[model samples]
Target: APAPPAKKPEIKAREGFEVDGQESDDLPPVFTTVPTKEKIVFLTIDDGAEKDPAFLRMMSELKIPYTVFLTDEEIKDDYGYFKKMQARGVTLNNHTLSHPYLPALSYEEQKHEICGMQDVMEKRYGKRPVLFRPPFGNYDRDTLRAAKSCGIEYAPIWSEEVFVDHWEYREWDQDLHPGDIVLTHFRGTDDWDG
Candidate 1:
């Protein structure tokens, strides 16, 4: 049998964005990429629109680690699918309650969307996540403030995006890099032409 996966390294937040476990005046940092030189890229899947059993089995067998940001509206139909993922050690973070564009909503509205999901996740998943991702990678100051108030410590966007058949890059080099955060949606053949 193959060797067990190595223990993951402790991830330290980028300087000036570190959380000291105490409240601060600054909003949580919004970073598109991490600060590191390791030859590793974080995979983050957004929305819980698809619940393909084969995909779940493949990832489990392959031992690929990933993080998920779920919108309550999309996953409400099958929370059990994600509960299985959680049991397998996948960390599910907040993607708001309805995946609304945070920049368009009032501060109170944004809080409701973010905090509401925090409550749902805590109630359903047994733990609330400290990380959050604003829908569509869009956010304003109010969005960050609301997320902070909801106990979100980091709000990261993506440096690259992957689809069923193609990839998108935000950098001019158009290539993957160390510490990059790659984004993908919970989609299958039903949602895209694979």
Candidate 2:
């Protein structure tokens, strides 16, 4: 019999980035980047429109660690696709039920969009997500409030966005910094220009 792989060390949240009991009502800390000097960046993919097998194979082969923020409206089409991703040790977080522009929605509507997805995730994925990303990176206070009510503890916007052809950065310098959160969508050649 072959030797089993060694267990990986746990990654802890940075100081002041802790979630539980850190805020009143547990409203999630919103940030575009994690404050760290380590040579590490976070890769997050949004939505669930594409189910490219090659992408999954590449990530798995590369041993890349990434997170997925899924919208029920898109992922409900193929829940098993993400299940395979989960089996790869990926954590699926909440985007929303329908990926609506949350600021325009009333409080109740926003809660429905957020909390409803939390329910769907718990039912289908076996865990309620603690992280959320608002659609289009647009949100308001009500969005955070609703998300907190749904048990979300962190809401992150991207410091950089990755498209097929080029990358977009939030900073004036077109470069990546330590602790930067890079965002990408579940898009392929048909959806973006290469």
Candidate 3:
């Protein structure tokens, strides 16, 4: 038999891994969702509280509910305008105290923006919003943690958004789907007869 095999070199594996006190290794490399229900989906939109009359009429006519993540700045400019829709089952969520590029801000600053929105939305709306959307989709790890500090669940993120800023003829095609989170910066005065 070979001379006692040289004692196997002691091997060490990573004992633990954590970042920001969250287990780094325990987390999935990415987060994804699986649809649990057939054809059931949620619609979400962000920004624009600056007196868009056309969007209001369209929303009124459509008579379908959608969630809007509103910035404090946008709401402040005309915050009261949302109350009518709030009564109509439209969900209001916090985007930020003001639209800020959350990832670029320092940790404390990000916390301020995220928490500020949570605080104000609760005061103004009678409930703390459970959703948050980073302005311009600018977010980082800090942004996520800051949002969680308050009672916000991750808001919906979209890879594509259709902006109908102009009231063009094509907007009224009526082939819209339930899951499509349609976005329009402003609206036109007349209805497009489907």
Tens digit of lDDT per residue, candidate 2, span 75-163?
99899999989989899999999999998999999999999999999999899999999999887778888898879978887889998
Q: Write the per-residue lDDT of candidate 1 for residues 43-87, one digit (tens) a residue.
A: 999999989888789999999988999999999999999999999
How far out, in Å, is residue 5 in model 3? 63
Clashing pairs in 3: none
Output the TM-score of candidate 1: 0.88
Candidate 1 worst ten-residue window by lDDT: 1-10
Give the per-residue lDDT digits (tens) of candidate 3, residues 28-109: 1111121222343345667754555566678878875677888887678676677766876778887898798777799899
Tell me the lDDT of model 3 at 138: 61
Q: List the candidate numbers ranked by TM-score, top first.
A: 1, 2, 3
lDDT of each structure? 0.85, 0.85, 0.59
Q: lDDT, candidate 1, residue 98? A: 97
**Which candidate model has the greater TM-score, 1 or 3?**
1
